[model samples]
Target: MAHPTTSVLCTELGFEWPDGTTVLDGFHLAVGPGRTGLIGLNGSGKSTLLRLMAGELTPTSGTVRIGGELGYLPQGVTFDTARQVDEALGIRAAREALHAIEAGDTDERHFTAVGDDWDVEERARAVLDRLGLERLGLDRTTGELSGGEAVLLHLAALLLRRPDVLLLDEPTNNLDRRARSLLYEAVASWPGVLVVVSHDRELLQHVDQIADLRDGAVTWYGGNFAEYERTVAAQQETAERLVRAAEGDVQRQKRDLAEARVKLDRSASYGKKRAVTRNDPKVFSGKLKRQAQETAGRVRGMHTERLTEAKERLTAAEDAVRDDAEIRIDLPRTAVPAGRTVLHLDHVRLPYGPRADLELRGAERVALVGRNGSGKTTLLRAVAGELTPVEGEISTPVPLRYLPQRLDLLDDTLSVVGNVKRYAPAVGDNAVRARLARFQFRGGRADQLAGTLSGGERFRAALAALLLADPPPQLLMLDEPTNNLDLASVRQLTQALAGYQGALIVASHDLPFLRGLGITRWLELDGTLREVDPM
Candidate 1:
């Protein structure tokens, strides 16, 4: 159903928010065949651009020319949980018709539904296999699948459309390692024009090029995310060096201009004394003074121009340098002595999932890795006292807190300070304000409603509540802490975790992030928890 043009073009594209916030200004882009990875910070307009291209949003003052059929998979995919997988794939009617004819129920309407492409079921299964969903039954309701599985299911449906242009936003954010591998294979085999907006480094590595959106502009880099990172790293290094050279040049120009002025003053004074001592003619003395002033003005102007140019160059160079600020915090009284037993679980059993025994001593940093539905989240919830084990003896020597993936710990309607105060009722308003400021919520920012906060801000607010609790949780558990976070925010979280002197068990699929946390133990949950070598 696609035209022969097979190209996507945005000519002088412009878009703006209803609140008078300009998201994109005069952005132009031309995308052709092959996979293109669109990447940027959390709010760098990557999603906005995708929406514009998908025709879900109309550009305020530009034209979008798509010369082919399109299919879009949004960041948050929702489906009718009651619908079967076949229904979700848009093939239930065709499949039913095919089965009806085989059963000898010769209805003319059923024949029409079959059409020419009678292998809809085969094609559907193939796509599901490609996306690691072959194990999921076509007749099963969508509610039966896990969160990661649900995301893969939607992607499978999109791929079955066979569109000339495919737009995906953070498709791999919820996928596990195995599912990610399958998605990577699909990307590698894709032949049409593919454009995906994602922060997953592994997923971006499969792209033919990377489109970096920053400051309302798209900068193209050849090759994948790795190549983009290398290119930017090289540029920043060169930029920093140029800045240093420019600064030196400006200082030298300033010194030269001052020296020239001093010489000119001395010359004028010497000429005046000479004209008076030699009894020179008045006209000759006047001409000499005029020449001296003219020459000094020219010298001063030249140096001033050089200094101005140097300053301009310096500013441009400095702009290219990265200035990622680190998060710093103090977690007082959250420390556990080296020999203390922080947690002990004896034959702990969840209502569903593997029964296991575990223990945490002192300030051990544990990395919990597992596939979706493997009970990683359930275990964390049980530890946080949100859920009780069906049967087992679990003991905790200190206060514990859990940060779920949804970040529902804070009330959206309340201010960030109000949420933190809920956990620390005894702490006065002044003390709470002081603590929130350390979490980067200073003054009026601390008074902003949790619902109005950005993704990173909301995460920080939820974390602050846990940290400022009355008992000061000595054991912390986080589930997919880096999900949907920008790179800078991930770094900020790493820095914040570095300051927490407590027993930590973090369940996440981000291996790089777990390594950054300095994890002392690695636990994989399949049917049971087992400590494994990180390598």
Candidate 2:
């Protein structure tokens, strides 16, 4: 079914939190039918804009107009564990009504409840199957599903409604490769106004347009994520060139201004000497002094005005060149010597999933891949000593650190620096703050409570705490490390990891993120653990 060329419009939209924190001020955007990728740094209100468009939130001022029915999926979706798959699909009542009608119920209410959805259950099943949820029947409870499966289920529910305007927020954040491919197919074929907020580059490849939200404004581009990158790169290069030119002009103006001042000073000195040498009329002497002062003032004002204008131009040019910088820090003590065994798992059996025997050598990067519920996280926790193995003998030759998916490694009551300092009790406040600065939490930001920070900031804080711990981890274990990171934060993580010379084992579904780390080993966990080719 093809939808109308309906569009979503925001008429000078303005939004703010309850506590008077402004997010968007006089923002305006229009999204037409077909895929539009919404991208921005974390805390830049991309999610908020989607919420507003879906009517999940009302703008503080201005208007949001959608031309058709809408469906929305949030970044973190929550479902009741007791709810069955049918309930989660939002068709339990309708299904029950249809069954009653077939059982010869003469009540008009049952027919009313069933409405036009006579084949609702079949349609639900088909959509579920399309989204790779056929393995789990509709009678199964929500708790029986994995995180990625649940996300797909949410999307499936939205699709079942056949909304004309679909809004998905971070839809591919935790999906595996296959799940992402399915989602991409759905997005590519969607006929309605589809706006997706995501940092997943591959997913963004299916978009027809890219809308970038930054500093409370939207900039539209005419193509997919790759085209947006190329266009932005070209613009940035031009902006940087203009910045350099403006800087040179400013410097030249300053030099000219200084020369003008010198000439004015020399002229004043000469005028004074001439007046002393010539015993002319007092009026003539006064006129000559006035003229000299006027001429000097004119020259000084002209140069000063030119210099100010040049400086302003330089400032504007610099502003056009985005100043977003990635995190760069060194952790040399984390280096491990070649051939040193950093970890050894002798016939380890997971409590719920796989069994394996493994030996991890110095500075080896490993990618742990599998479907959801395959126990990648359990294996990591066991290796980190956070969980007791059902049957295993594990040895760690060096200090280790574990970063879980939830990133609950920090105390919410404490500040970021406090969290790092707690992990490294021997480290002083100054040292901790210095390290936090490298993580991009400079000055007062280091003192913000962990509970108050945004998703990206909290992840950086968690990473900083883990890496800055005492003795320095030579073995770092991360579970779904890139789960909710925006593109900038992901790049920051990559930059920071590039400097850490440690053995890393990261369980993540993001193939690009894994490849970015330059994985030397690939291990897939099922009921059995086995090594797979990295390629």
Q: What TM-score goes with each of the models?
A: 0.87, 0.94
Q: Write the per-residue lDDT of candidate 1 for residues 1-535, one digit (tens) a residue.
A: 2235547888888998764557788888888888999877655677778899998999999888887788888866767889999999888998999999999999999999989868888998888887877788889898767778888888888788888899988787667789888988888788899998876788888999998877888889999989999999999889889889888988988898889889888988999999999998999989988998899889889888888888888888888887655678988689989788998989988868678789889999999988877888888888778888988988988888889988888898899999999999999999999988877888988998886665667888899899889889889999988876767778888988888999999998888889999999999988878999993
Pairs with backbone N, CA or C atoms under 3 Å apart (clashes), candidate 2: none
**What's the residue-level lDDT of 431 in candidate 2?**
91
Per-residue C-alpha lDDT of model 2 across residues 282-321, encoded as one tens digit per residue: 8998999999899888888899999999999999999999
Provide the clash count, candidate 1.
0
| Native-referenced Cα lDDT, model 1 | 0.85
Which ranges of candidate 1 are over 4 A from the true structure? 1-6, 264-298, 328-333, 410-472
**Global lDDT scores for all candidate models:** 0.85, 0.88
Residue 4, model 2: Cα distance from true site in angstroms: 10
